[model samples]
Target: MKILTTPDIPIATLFQNMREVYATCNVDVSWASEEVLNLPALNIVDVGTCILGSTTAEQNQLFTHRNSAGSNDIVIYFVEATDPPFNGCASHPLGMPGAVVVRTATQWTFAHEQGHVLGLNHVNDNDRLMTGNGTANITNPPPDLVASECNTMQASPITVNV
Candidate 1:
């Protein structure tokens, strides 16, 4: 999966955290600036990022196809939640095909959001990256498990045209 991050600082850091997790799985992932989410390398998992307060209604309006785009492309918006939901959530009120908003600027929050993009539901096991209740110590898991478990979770990526 490939993630497209805007020029936001915290959002870029969140992408870095995802790279770390991908490394743990021994999975190769490549991301570009807000400009490139369609490179051939990124077959599945296209995510976009924007900062809190910086994103305007105009920007959100551009992605109107998300509601029923049919493509698996999901945009992840980094917003400051009035109160961070301890549990994981999708950015839009309608839920599916929208970005995942995180209240904090922490790396764990990004990882948690990425977990949603990867098709893993909230797992109660704290050791698992998908464990969605608050922050779990899942920054890095064993590399083999990352690749193996992640593949097991999503056999075919619904996103990405490849």
Candidate 2:
């Protein structure tokens, strides 16, 4: 879904970046729909709040309140600002199901948020996607995932259905 002031982001390019960001992971990355070459893909706008603060009327309460976000369906909400410290976030309240918020829609942002959707958490490794406050730089490598993380991600109910 499109958030206020984010229709101008380059979704196709950024999405590709996300795919590359998770290349090392066991999960596959594909557009939810066709490739959006336009500056603003979807025009429908709504409340696009960061994962850490969902108190606003627009943020998804189900995720923010339950203490579980980005554990379910990948809802990529494009907002207009980078006020939030994180580039993206998992949106699910139960089991990490939720939408991914992309202010800049960078490749790292997409992949980092997806990491959360896959039930992965942050780490101290700067070289990994799970690094605390994952980087948006394209030069960085993909997020790191061990056999266990891959197993957990692959076995998740959401991934299985996909």
Candidate 3:
């Protein structure tokens, strides 16, 4: 995973937390980061904008980072706080998957979005990592990574980095 942050903020703790969380899945993540992006959160969206409500201009600004798949990397863009939203964007491009997380996001939000990046879909059960839309708290979810999802994640190109 490559974490992209604004020049003024730090994301090392969040990165470490994500590493710890992914450890339970036996996915060893190697990371690199760029903390010199001059852009701020408000520059991309309105002060209280929802992460998912990324406008074309905002997405274009984000795409400027060129998060392509030459390395099959999953990118994470850390921004400042937002309004009452899901915390960040968990978007999976057709060939390259990535996420956008707020500074307030917990480790679960990172892992949950990573699940989507790895081709996992949302489930109705709140006990699972892929649970949300209707009921997903910031707390612990149950132990569940179905065999199929595991296979899919294992098959991804980012597995090479593991």
Across residues 1-162, which tens digit of lDDT does each residue of candidate 1 receive?
Answer: 222333234556766766776566544444422332432222221223333223334334434434323454455543333222332243332233445443333555555555555555566666666654445455444211355566743463633422
Across 11-88, the per-residue lDDT of candidate 2 in tens digits comes to 676677666645555467655432222233222223345443343333443233322223444555554433344455
Model 2, residue 80: distance off in Å is: 1.2
> Order the candidates by lDDT, highest first — what do you get?
3, 2, 1
CA displacement after TM-score superposition, residue 86 of candidate 2 (Å): 3.3
What is the Å distance of residue 97 in model 3 from its true position?
3.1
TM-score of model number 1: 0.52
Question: What's every prediction's RMSD, in angstroms?
Answer: 9.6, 6.6, 4.7
- In model 1, where do residues sit more than 4 Å from their true spots? 1-9, 32-70, 82-88, 91-96, 136-148, 159-162
Backbone clashes in candidate 3 total: 0
Clashing residue pairs for model 1: 24-143
Model 2, C-alpha of 139: deviation from truth (Å): 6.7
Better model by lDDT: candidate 1 vs candidate 3 = 3
Candidate 3, residue 121: the lDDT equals 77
